[model samples]
Target: MEEVIVTVLSEVRCHLGEGPAYDVASDTAWWFDILERRLFEARLGKGEAQVHPLPVMASALAYVDDARQLIVAEDGLHVRRVADGHLALHVPIEADNAASRSNDARVHPSGTLWTSTMGRKAQTGAGAIYALHGGVLSRLFGNITIPNAICFSPDGGTGYFSDTHENVLHSVPLDPATGLPVGAPSALYRHHGEGGLDGAVTDAEGLIWCARWGAGCVDAYTPAGERVRTVRVPAKQTSCPVFVGADFGRMLVTSAYEDMDEAARAADPQHGRTFLLDLSARGRPEPRIKLGAI
Candidate 1:
């Protein structure tokens, strides 16, 4: 276990910060405060983050270009113009269903967008994973309680996600041509540690960097389920981790303070802040989403 020191990047007291991703075009980092209905973007070592309030509660996002973004919000996926922060509804994904909202999401190397929906109140078995391609949305799996870690392998041959409530991570074979699941998913990793698996991202070398929700660290594991390294953070409820910096040599971690009580918050005042860690491991840039309407 290598002890890595992380610096506080943002002190924005977020309730449930998640969906941290790097934008290669702008050379910046972006994430969402799901409960606060806000999105934040910042340049490394620059100034304060520029905050934009989303019309609906947004969970995850991916860059469409340097000037636009694809956001998965309470009303489904929308195209947001970055210049004026204008959001236009592009696709209605469960907009009529008030019980659920979008959660973890990412873009595939094959130009497809994948996302998950969970019950707003954390209701059991009220969520599922979905894929959006060719202007169509399809559900991949169902009966999920809390979906997280929706990421893909470096080779784009596999997809990984987890049901946090179950503390089990699963993987599925993906079709290279269509970017859809080719077969059934199998259990890849089970968290018997102090924390459950939350959001995750795959490194350039095909290692999965998972944020352990209550463990206060990010664990790097091989594709074959071998834990190799651990990087600890100051916060207890780590939400997600994104590899960034020049050539993706650094990591930015997001955490939460949503469910903590008074005593817990006092014990760790940096619970909701973002952390930046200098890393020797390099990472590949995230693929830009290819939405049909865009």
Candidate 2:
């Protein structure tokens, strides 16, 4: 049970902040306020974050290249130009299902993008997980309430996801070449305490760092599902975590005040604020997503 101190990275509060990502080439960090339909960007160690209002609700993103980004949104996968922030539809996800929106996502070492979709109102069994690679999409899991913790191992041979509603994390063997699962997912860990599993990321040592919603902490576990460390966050609803900085020695965590009442919001004053943590763990650089002819 190790603890680390965190400082506010962005002061702008969000109703539902998630999907923090970092682009090493530009030395910038990006995240989303999902409910607000807004995207935020900040240079590592910069003073403040710049806000961009989006036309749709987007939860996650992957750097396609220096000039483009792949955004996982409510409607579909959008290709966003870096120069002017122009966005064009690359592909539709659950576009016909207006009740569903994108959730947590992460990129595999093989240049595959793994994303999830969830019901707008958190409807039971109204979500699923998908993997997109070379412009093709494949549904890996379905009948999920809240698909999250979408991450992969350093070797890309293991994929991890969690249904927050069930408070259980699952792991599946993946085909590293295609980023597709080769076997059924098995339960890796179940939380019986305060918070549920939200989002997670794997480090260079193959350790999983997961945010615990409503618990105000991030927990680290070995690949064997043994909890090893915990990092306390000021915000209760910690949603996601991403490695940032030039050396990827720092972690950026996003929080939310989505379902908080007035009293709860007041009690958790730091809710919805993104934080930067200095820790000993090192992170692997996020791989650029491979895009085929669209």
Candidate 3:
């Protein structure tokens, strides 16, 4: 078990730090504090991070281009004006339901978007996964709780996602042309009770790297469910992993200090901070959302 050293990149603490995405064109990265309703961005290697306020609980985002970002907020999917930090409603998805909010999300290689929504109270079966293609939004699954691990395989033929509370990872066959699932999803891996699965990302080698919430580490698994590598960070509540930095040779992990008491925070000063790890494997840029005239 080879270990990688984790370095704290930012000291900002988030109640729930998730949704990490790198913008290659801008040489920056973006993440969100869902509970705080804040968005953060910073240059790859230089400068201070900038914080932007969101009107709603902004869970995840995908790059629309260098100048705009597509976001899944509490209300619905929106197009964010990067220059002015303005968000415009693009598609309405359960906007009237205050109990349900956007959760995990990612874009597909075919310019489509896949995002999930969950109940605010963590109610059972109060969530579902949705896919947006060619200006149409469709639900993929229902009766889900704590949706996470939304990623795709390198070839774009497989889609991976999981419900944190279920402690299982699933893989489904996808339509390459439309980036939608063509068949039923099956279990690829099960975490048992070690820790719940959270956000995940696929590397250039087609491996899925997942953050185990209470395990303080990120594990990589092959499509066949074999554990290949494990990289430990200092934070106990690791939230998500995103490949960033020069040549995509680095992994940026987000953490959370939410619900931690004074003694807990004192023991782990880096609890909610962001961390960077130097990795040998490279990563491809996340797919950009192709908003055709929307």
Q: Local distance difference test, per candidate?
A: 0.88, 0.92, 0.89
In model 2, which runs have C-alpha deviations exceeding 4 angstroms? Answer: none
TM-score of each: 0.97, 0.98, 0.97
The residue pairs that clash in candidate 3, if any, are none
Tens-place lDDT digits, model 2, residues 109-214: 9998899999999999999998888889888899999999988989999999999999999999999998998999999998899998999999899999999999
lDDT of 3 by residue, 1-294 (tens): 357876777789989999989987777988999999999887866866888988888888998877789988888998998899888999988877789989999888898899999999878999999999998998998989989999998788999999998988999999987889999999999887667899999999999999999878899999998888988888889999999976888998999988899998898878998888888778889988987777
Better of 1 and 2 by TM-score: 2
RMSD of each: 1.2, 1.0, 1.2
Query: Which ten residues in a row are the worst by lDDT in model 2?
Result: 41-50
lDDT of 2: 0.92
Show the colliding residue pairs in model 1.
none
* Best candidate according to TM-score: 2
Deviating ranges (above 4 Å) for candidate 3: none
| Candidate 1, RMSD to the unseen true structure | 1.2
